[model samples]
Target chain A: MGETRLMKGNEAIAEAAIRAGCDAYFGYPITPQSEIIEYLASQEPHKRTGMVLLQAESELGAINMVYGAAGTGKKAMTSSSSPGISLMQEGLSYMAGSELPCLVVNIVRGGPGLGTIQPSQADYFQATKGGGHGDYKLIVLAPASVQEMSDFVPLAFDLAFKYRNPVMILSDGVIGQMMEKVELFDQMPRATEFDQTWVTTGKTADRERNIHSSLDLDPARFEKHNHHLQEKYKKIIENEVRFEKIQCDDADYVLVAYGSSSRICQKTQKLAREKGIKAGLLRPITLFPFPYEEIEKLANHVKGFLAVELSAGQMVEDVELAVGKKTRIEFYGRIGGMIPTPTEILTVLEEKYLGG
Target chain B: MNEEIIIAGFGGQGILSMGSILSYSGIIENREVSWMPSYGPEMRGGTANVTVILSSERISSPIINTYDTAILLNQQSLDKFENSVRPGGLLLYDTNGITRHPERTDISIYQVEAAAEAGKMASTKTFNMIVLGAYLKIKPLVKFENVITGLKKTLPERHHHLIPLNEEGLKRGMEIVKEVQLG
Candidate 1:
């Protein structure tokens, strides 16, 4: 337990990173997410925790800085919106290939190209299935509230280090801009000592020099590395399937949603239950190691499942893949920054399941 | 009880601040609250609005189309959100520069001459406090003491001196608010 204060999600993420003993924050400003960097800059984390806070010229530059810092075994992070995150995909791929642990936050906004600054969950496929060119995955945590926005920062870093992989806090503009009560934790000192066997921190007399690069020219070596990466991802999927089920014990109909859409679905579940329709919500907290097993188990008993999102059927594909042909899985979404209301979701449920 | 309110006005009219203060008041009263403002280009001199939700339990959604209360500070907000208030809900408007009056008969409409009072007090900055005062007089969702405490928490130490003036403006607003008789 800590001091509770009403704070914005973006600001909370910044403060949480500082409290989590992050070594550095390098980010470029973007709509719906600029607050993260702005808050960090204002707090002067350099003064408070001897952390390095630099404003990079571009998202590419910021992510590269993170890759450089993480290569030295330092806890580093960068945040941006969708288009900006797209710019960092190449860098992210390099980091994943090099097995670097770092945190990247995407406070998502609607986009195909430089889209609106309103909230959206359109980056589901881009985040989970690997936006970069590789057989790799980032541990993606989708936070639905300001509290989770704060809580997930440390969790993302812990997991990123635990698996030696990049982690992403997949939030949206709604959560980034919204203000809610959050209990902030006490400050933890930055990790001064960690296993630096693989870190490039200048070779010692007794140790062999370590080189950090993803450029494996030998085909067999690259294939072995890919297999190793696949093994790690398999371990992550087996060990890190996190989700929250609300009223799902005897649900006749279930709604699969995440991030801000999950909050709306929670309300829709209550509205449906009030009308005698048994609706439940399964919110995937970990989007990468998605709760496929839970969804599959639920599919056996539930009559149907509706995948609701702030995008045109993105996560619905994952839901379909998870449940297979056990039950009917439908998708209802609003794209281009348009959020579907609870009433709209309820109406869809009625039209699809209940006799209107 | 849950109160989902939309406070809309011009960018410089402290629309967002009012919502923030209301949310802080909810915290003071030990209630769950959320304050979400419309950001980006619209916040630059254009109409700005914030959705403030206060509930005894955890608030699920911060964004909602309909509202239990619509506090319109200008004609644009009145025209935009007048119909969004739920039936038997409250629509409080400051009779400042509103040209088109709200015509919703299903909801309770109240007018507060907050702008005129603020002008008389010679400080346009206190205008939002007056409007907030009117909302409190009508709904009384949070205690007046909690509102004052919320004001202290929201204001910086350098601006703490203005609290008395805001308190005066709030009292003036409470006195000037009048319920409209819908035919």
Candidate 2:
């Protein structure tokens, strides 16, 4: 524990990035998430830790800047909301193809297009199923609280570098704008020594020249590279599945949710338990990994599962797949930036699972 | 004890700040606290609202439709949130802008002339502080000293001079607030 401070989620992310020894931050200002870049700019990280903080003209420019810096083995990151993230998908795909390690924070807002700036979890498929064009995947971490927002920055960087892949922090307007007390971590100096064998930092006399490009042109080479990427993804799936189970051991029903929706589901579970419903919450901390095995195990004991989200229905598809024909999986959500209240979720649980 | 509160008013009325101060006070008392503000276009000048939850144990959700307490500053807020107060909960409102008083029979209602009182004060910025003061008087959820410490944490150092004035406003609010007796 470094220091306990009452801060907004976006501010926590910015401060966490600095403490995580991030080498550079490049991002455009967007509502519900602009505070991240604003706080970073105000801190003058460039002055404090010699970190580079640049405000890109657009989300595209910011993501491409991340790509450029990450290609050189620097801990670089960029943040954006829904529409802006959509704009960065091309860059994200390119980064994934080049196998560059970088962090992308999506403080998601409601959207098929330029939707409302309020919170929404509609980007589940966009994030977990590869928003960008490719067979590549980003290690997506869903942070539910300001503390998680702070903690995930460093965790994301570590995982990104370990796998040599792009990682995304899938948050939303609620988590971005809400304020809560968070225990921050002590400052860690920028990583000075890491494997730079694949970095494009100019060739030395003794080392072979390195190239960072997504295009192989040769079909055979590209196919082999895709296979290698698939192998890495398989390893991540086996080891990186992270989920939290609250009162799940003897639960009759389970509530599956992520990010902000998980917070509401926790309350719903408590309410249900008070009413002798034997409810539990299964919160997937990592959306990309999906925590399929955990849900499958829970399905054996629970009567049903409710996949709650801030969107109409996205993650529920994955839950259904995990539960298979063994148990019923239902979805309850509110769209267009509307957040479902705890009572609403509880009412849904009562109606759908409690046979009320 | 867990208190789920909603503070609502005109965007510039400092409703969000009041919620922030209350949440900070909870933190000062080592309670789990969350303060969530209404974001986006409605916050520009329309009715702005914030949901604040303070609990002895970990807080589950900050988004709530019903509240244990409601601090309403404007008529719009009063109209919107008067019914949102749970039965036996408290509804605190400023009489300055409300045309219709809260009609809830099951909940406790209190009135404070914070806006008119702020008009008499040196600065109108202490308006929310006065209402907060009344809230503390009714519930006394956290210690008054904790609120002072919370103010120190929430307000920047340069704004420290206004703390004394805000405290004065809070004291005044506590003195003047009156509960509406039901028939």
The TM-score obtained for chain B by all candidates, in the order given, is: 0.96, 0.96
Model-by-model DockQ, in order: 0.82, 0.88
Cα RMSD of all models vs. native, in order, equals: 1.3, 1.3
Candidate 2: regions farther than 4 A off = A192-194, B41-43
TM-score of each: 0.98, 0.98
Cα lDDT for residue A212, candidate 2: 93
Worst 10 residues of 1 chain A by lDDT: A188-197
lDDT of each: 0.92, 0.91
Per-residue CA lDDT of model 1 for A88-168, tens digit only, reads 999999999999999999999999899999999999999999999988899999999999999998888888888889999
Task: Please provide, for model 2 over B24-79, each residue's C-alpha lDDT reduced to its tens digit, 9 standing for 90 to 100.
Answer: 88988889999999975344678789999999998889788999999998888899
Model 2 agreement with the true structure over A137-248: per-residue lDDT tens digits? 9999999999999999999999999999999999999999999999999999898355779998889999789999999989999999999999999999998999999999
